[model samples]
Target: MILGRSAISMAIGIWSIVEQAVAQHASNNRAKGAPITKNVSMTRAVYTKLLREKVFPAIRKKWPGRKTTTIMVQQDNAGPHVQDDNADILEAGQEGGWDIQMVSQPPRSPDMNVLDLGFFLFVAVATIQDTFDTDGLIAAVKSSFAKVSYHTLEKCF
Candidate 1:
């Protein structure tokens, strides 16, 4: 998952054996100053690749001319994001064209990361309220997400 907080907006998705989670994040428009908009995906390698290659690139295109610095926060899962094959991503960033930072592992605390709580709230609020069919639930989740006004996000800080 791409856990970040900044002026620019971001997106994230998650696919677990039990369920799939997706979140679209934007910086709070009000006073606390603009924070990085983080796009995160909580999924295994296959899904994460789908999001990174297909989804992220498409979304990245919308923000033309914007420089994107990547920082990966990985949990102890066996996925491409955590595999050696993906080292090139960090290497590419270290090549000096873009800023890259990695969150430390081992003893890492998810609570310390704002995105952690953000993601939790996103999932909790999105899936709550009532039971529905697949499509209906999808609509409910989207509608719930839409209802998260700037005021709610600001309170997260």
Candidate 2:
């Protein structure tokens, strides 16, 4: 999902890369006609694509005030994550005169990466629901994200 916010705002929106497809093998454990959820591996190419197509647009759209606002996107030091100055990302960030840069969290500093702490909480809340299918699961996640209190988000940031 494309997650980041000003001190006053919530997440931009929920955007999972999951896709639905027919299950290759039916298991006795699964309910009849249950949907299958496939998670995509996050590669650098995939990550860069998301930044160009999803994150940059969302940030530009949701950011409050001023046309020339500069934004710093803070992410963890994951292998799939792109460098701060990736050419394609830099091009996307420079679009329409905006300056957006990706900054990685320092190594060996899990406490500094609070984004994951809150993000995982959202997942925990989502999984608590008795969702039966992809649509139901998506609804559950959206509901959970919607319920995130400003006070809670304030603490996370």
Candidate 3:
């Protein structure tokens, strides 16, 4: 799931909420190798696609008349994330007439990330009354993400 909040306006932008199907484990009696339950990890390819196909477009739509030529996307220092100078990303940005740049946050700085600072807590509170299965959890998360107010987000900054 990808969620963005505007720096100035504190507007929320929910780009995508994709769920990965869990791999089923085989019967315990079987001695043969079986697929273990897997959670999809974000890779450079997935991140790049999220930026090019989802994030950028949502940003453009959010501020229709504003110049988006110098948009900067801030991300955590994850191993699978693409570097700022990645060729495909640069090309995509250029094609969209945007000067998109991926910037990594300072190491171990949870304070700098709004999601870490407050959003997750807010979501947790919101979801306290709900009970859900795996797929329902995804839906609940997405719903909670949408319901978060701009004022709440602004306070986190």
Best by lDDT: 2
The collision pairs in model 2 are none
Computed on alpha carbons, the lDDT of every model, listed in order, comes to 0.46, 0.73, 0.63
Candidate 3: count of backbone clashes, pairs at least 3 residues apart or interchain: 0
* Model 3 ranges off by over 4 Å: 1-12, 15-39
Runs with alpha carbons beyond 4 Å of true place in candidate 2: 1-10, 28-35, 131-136
- Per-residue CA lDDT of candidate 1, range 1-157, in tens? 4334444334434322223333334434323433322334445565445544553444345434543545443433334334424564455434434434344444445545555466457757777866444544555655655665545555566
Better lDDT candidate (2, 3): 2
TM-score of each: 0.48, 0.78, 0.72
Q: Is candidate 2 or candidate 3 better by TM-score?
A: 2
The sequence of per-residue lDDT tens digits that candidate 2 reaches over residues 38-96 is: 77788998889888888888887887464466677777788999888788888898898
Ranking by TM-score: 2, 3, 1
Model 2, poorest ten-residue lDDT window? 1-10
Candidate ranking (lDDT, best to worst): 2, 3, 1
The candidate that wins on TM-score is 2
